[model samples]
Target chain A: MDILLEMLEKDARLTPEQIAIMTQKDEGDIKAAIDSYESRGVILGYKALVNWDKTEREYISAIIELKVTPQRDRGFEKIAEKIYNYPEVKSLYLMSGAYDFQVILEGKTLREVAQFVASKLAPIDGVISTATHFVLKKYKDNGCVFKVPEKDERINSI
Target chain B: MTDYSKKLSKTAQSISPSGIRKFFDILDDMDDVTSLTVGQPDFATPWHIREAAIDALSAGKTYYTSNAGLTPLREEISKYVKRRFSLDYGKDEIITTVGGSEAIDLAMRALIDPGDEVIIPVPSFVCYGPIARLAGGVPVYVDLDEKDGFTLTPEKLERAITPKTKLLVLPFPNNPTGSVMRLPELEKIADIIEKKDIFVLSDEIYAELTYKGRHVSIASLDGMRERTIIASGFSKAYAMTGWRLGYTLAPREISVQMLKIHQYAIMCAPTASQYAGIEALCAGDEDIEYMKAEYDRRRLYIVNCLRSAGFECYEPLGAFYVFPNISKYGLDSESFCSRLLYENKVAIVPGTAFGSCGEGFARISYAYSVKHISSAVEKLADFANKIKNERKL
Candidate 1:
């Protein structure tokens, strides 16, 4: 099962016959492995990457460092529940020290972020202070980096 | 919560909320706003082009066109490419789309596989990344330098590519910044792309509206024809935004794939619009020249006005926008834009809405008439004076 999972992860595009050949297993075994993985919810889904910089729609992203006081019995989970509930919060993380949590919110403009800070998160009970940092540059994310080869690298190295 | 809400894919839910639309919504409800916030050309469709659409309707040519678009229109587009930028593409390689928007959509859908990396330069058109994601590709952004007139240097391009890089969206004749790439600039890009086996989505929608030397296509360079998809439309040139006609020229295999997706999603671009497009290609030269001249006039007027008013205005060499640096006002782009709209009744899009690099600037469109341009500039100048006085700058 581990070998099967490894092969599938390496190349999702590999055909069953190809996977079987690579794994030294029967095609039936490869097919069953894929089916079981799907049934067990291991291979969730596929997605596309969009170059928003070139498109017509606008994109704004910000990481909001949230300072919160944990409730007695509910602890930080209760505060996290409120922060993550908003649809604008793309990602939320419970952290250690300094900041209690970090929430990534995406909106159309700075005003929208300001509004969210004032109206939504700040007003929530037990929520302390929040500092928002807009992402200035995204050098790498989701296993993709935007870097072309140097002229020498392009010429000499593959 | 509704059960139907669960059916939405993560991608669908992840669509970046539109910054422009959000502001526009606010401006819409406000009665006193004089808006320059829109990215579209304020010019109406040229009379000759409109006549062509009217003629098409009169002649009862209001049926669906071939999925790829009318042959004559495609042929004219092919000729337009050659005559304008020395790029050669046959009618077979062209797909007429709903708009340049759709052309971009089709290109991404056709080329991007899941997890493929697409390089996008900022601050630029906002649609590229979202559309790429919808097509199962990841968008990686490279910030273009303001010091370099927002032009994407070969150094920047090289630093932005990776092993997973599958597509690079070249949005020159850029929005917000109004930068353009010349032949020498394109050659550097061509050199890098030749070895990478990556596809290029060259969005030259504002190709005809350039104020600098003629627009050049990277695809025209050696070995680039096969690797680049040229997406353009008559929207800016013929003032045909409402017509909803744009096209993409690519290698035949890619065109075929794009057409397959386009056919499934959009049966055909508007039929009358295609005929009008043919007319636009065949006889819209005078209209193009007239509108270009008008835009040039407003461009000069606005730039001069902004500069004389103590704003650091970047002279946009292409597109119909003047992105002026408003940092001295000590207000962020969003605050500056909103306050301008509220106080002076003049609306401009915040540069921050374009990208992070767009902070400290505001995009003011000169696509309006000279009269509106003068009035808006006067109001803007007064607003700037007020801010400077209050802030003691």
Candidate 2:
């Protein structure tokens, strides 16, 4: 299952016939493997790589760290729900250590974040305090690095 | 069947979208991503400028002024331009619009026709191409090389020109890539435009934000005055983005057309904003100097940090962004930005978002607080080290 999943991840566009040829299995087996992966929710959805910087809409990003007291029964889920409700709140996660929740948000400017905190997140009952940290740089994410690979450097080289 | 949906114009539909927003959307979906993706200033609209707006509101200056903008504001802009860039224009020649953005749109609309080619140097501000298209012009994107500090040299400019070319959009103290074309560079471009009879739409929004040397307007050059339209505003210089006030300086014939467009399209810029703009132009020189000094500090810091982290960064001469060559990562800009946001929680705009030439580069804006800039650099260095280690596997 792991090998099949790995192969599919590498080439999600691979046809059943093609997979069958590579794995020396029947088309039915390849189709079944794909079906099982989708059924198990391993294969999500495909997306186009959009070049957003050229678009009309201005891209504004910030990372906000929140310190909150977990409510009874609901605890972090309730806080997370409250934070995620705003359309501007693109992502939210309960984090360990000094900060309780880390939120990733997008808006037109810094004032947008301030407004979100003032109007939406701050009023929530369990929220004790919040510290908003705007994002300044991103080097890598989701197995993609922003640097080009050199020809001389092999994968094994440190 | 009755048509229920409003039809968007083909021009509107065909508008090339901004690439900066994509990674921003992704970063928005992640938790704790540190980002230097913005292209604006970190400082607040200076106290005096804000106070001027407030004072105007308090004094019941809420009523709309002339479509060309307040007389005092236009006069101030006239003086400011002359004082700053040594460009001469009457108050009537300038029309205050909503940010330098509106100025660009107006210039294109006032001049360009359908099928007319608008030559734009690439890896520039995101608005030029789309705005050119909206004005019924075909955007002819010319990729500027990193070797020339991402500037459009005489050869590049002359080569990009065709008989169909009507307008040339020069975005300097450029965005994405922090390149500035000084007087010498401007002279080379002016010489070409003189021979070609092409109109120049110079976006000098970052005119006052230059770190080293002074900004020279193409209009200031010989024979270029009649053909050059200067687009600038108080947004970057005065940290007045929310105010949405800007102006253009052109020949009276062009200004007349631009005023007609402004009168119909926007009616007038915000009333208080015009008043604040007056204050920014007249009294905000000190504030501009202060902000530029701070930005210079952050700029140097980021450049050094990127260099130390094994990235090759062309020393940015103007603007607050540092475009670092990230080709060593073996990933494209999108993948690079996504991975950076997801794994290390550091977000920077991939250079490809600017244009095709921006591939294998990332634009990190230094228009942030020194503290944020330092911390982001630290986090980025860590991410670079991690990638270096991971490639070993």
Candidate 3:
């Protein structure tokens, strides 16, 4: 991977100028590279990894292990496309194990997610069975550790 | 009342406490101080290495190993230096000590006679002088030129060495200064040492942190192998400072003496840490690269930030600290750093903490998160602006 992309992946707040100095590249080149990455769809979007659990916002997320039959002309791609189009389906992946599709859904409450899985998801023609496991807490998200930063316990010495 | 000062060893008594001790006290009383004063890696020990130690503990390898340390670990260290550093060492030539500090001390004790002079470059690590004095050796300090990237040039080294010079302490990837000695630079210095025929105690503790071409050990040079003793450990490389594991690589004669000191003083390095050291040598190359890249980014960031904030900072190519010149404020290093700590609520070490040659400088460690360093740099920039405004008034 490009060093600039790696830097931005870890921290999107960093400016092109700062990254130029860090990677010892021209600032103009960094800007151009970032532009190319964005236009080429290599960079999907810049989003903050917020710990919403700590905020006053009400949120619930669940991973629904799905078992489904593929359409005759298409494999799991058709079903995955159908399931990903739903607003609550935050993440969708075709699995290689006991389950066919692994759908991650997020909503305001536990019932909202279960309602999506039951009414919107299970009602699909190709959908065979659905097993929903609500996420209780997040210890990590993306690459960021979901916890208060640990105080540096080391005593300063020369 | 008793006069306790007179009862202590005069050698120990004469050595002053670290100049940064005042900052420690001041910082202790403060709150929300964004400090860049750490001298070790901020990263945790890699989980695989830690897991190896845990495995050893579970397997009940609690007993002490040999004075020279576990043979497998010693062999692993041999392979590690060979592949990572191109350093060749036989198994018997390495003796694991309790951290690099003890390796340094062992080298000092094993080699120094009462009146021998040990040449050390200044504005480097703080331990060499005191340890040399304790070993009854006279510390001959040669101030490194900032223009030379705080590296000891051949001329300066030649000028400092007397007929009584027994050892020249080469501390590349130096602490506080963050100076790295590249091969050409080291080769020049190595030429002088070979001619002068003095033993070299090369402290490459920050060897893995070199950001330039590569760290060149004087031992790797032409005829200096027999004279050079490298004292290093996993503390900086693997972020295993708490493990207290370090070793010394030297010739058989010196290793024999160092082993004697190890037997008498340390017995061996910690058993579990030795196990972890083996794992680090075997599988921690990726971990080193990962942490070193993070540090390289932080190094460039801190140097650029300090330069923009109206200070003269050399782009450090090694280690985790940036020794920015703070002499422009018409204040000494200690005074400048004290004001930063008290007023800005940011703690960085005065350069004099490392050596008197560091009197006009300050060391800000980049062994921290970018956010943490940015906040401190912001406060520092504000403080510098205020100082500028007041001077104008």
Give the DockQ of candidate 3: 0.76
Predicted candidate 3 versus true structure: per-residue lDDT over B1-393, tens digit per residue: 879898888999999887677679878888988888888889889999999999999999999999999999999999999988899999999999899999999999999999999999998888998999999999999998788889888889989989999999988898989998888888888888888889999999999999967787888888888998999998999999999999999999999998988898878889999999999999999999999999998888888889888889988889898998888887888888888888888898988887788888988899998888888899999988887787772
Worst 10 residues of 1 chain B by lDDT: B32-41
Q: Model 2 fnat?
A: 0.00
**What tens digits encode model 1's per-residue C-alpha lDDT throughout A31-105?**
987888899999765445445555677777899888877899999888888889899998899988899888988
Per residue, candidate 2 scores C-alpha lDDT tens digits across B1-393 of 655335657667666566566556665566555568766776778878899889999999988899999999888888888898888999999999998889999999999989999999989878888888888899999999888888898998888999999999999989879899988889999989989999999999998878768887888999999999999988889888778989999999999999999999999999999988888888888999878876775676678667877888989988888999887877788788778878778878888888888999988888765556668888888877787787761
Query: What lDDT score belongs to each candidate, Candidate 1 first?
Result: 0.83, 0.81, 0.90
As for candidate 3, its interface RMSD to one decimal place is 1.1
Runs in model 3 lying further than 4 Å from the true structure: B1-3
Q: Which CAPRI tier for candidate 3?
A: medium
Write down the worst ten-residue block by lDDT for model 2 chain A: A149-158
Ranking by lDDT: 3, 1, 2
Q: Estimate each model's TM-score.
A: 0.70, 0.70, 0.96
Instruction: Give the share of true interchain contacts found in each model.
Output: 0.00, 0.00, 0.77
Best by TM-score: 3
Per-residue alpha-carbon lDDT of model 1 for B1-393, expressed as tens digits?
A: 677658888898888787667777777778756667666766667777788888999999878888998888999999988887788899999999999999999999999889999999999988998999999999999888778889989899888889999999999899878889888888988888987788899999999988747888888889999999989998888888778999999999999999999999998999889988988888888887767766775676678667877889877999988889988899999999889888889988898888888899888887665556767888999999999999998
lDDT per residue as tens, model 2, A26-46: 779878878887888887755
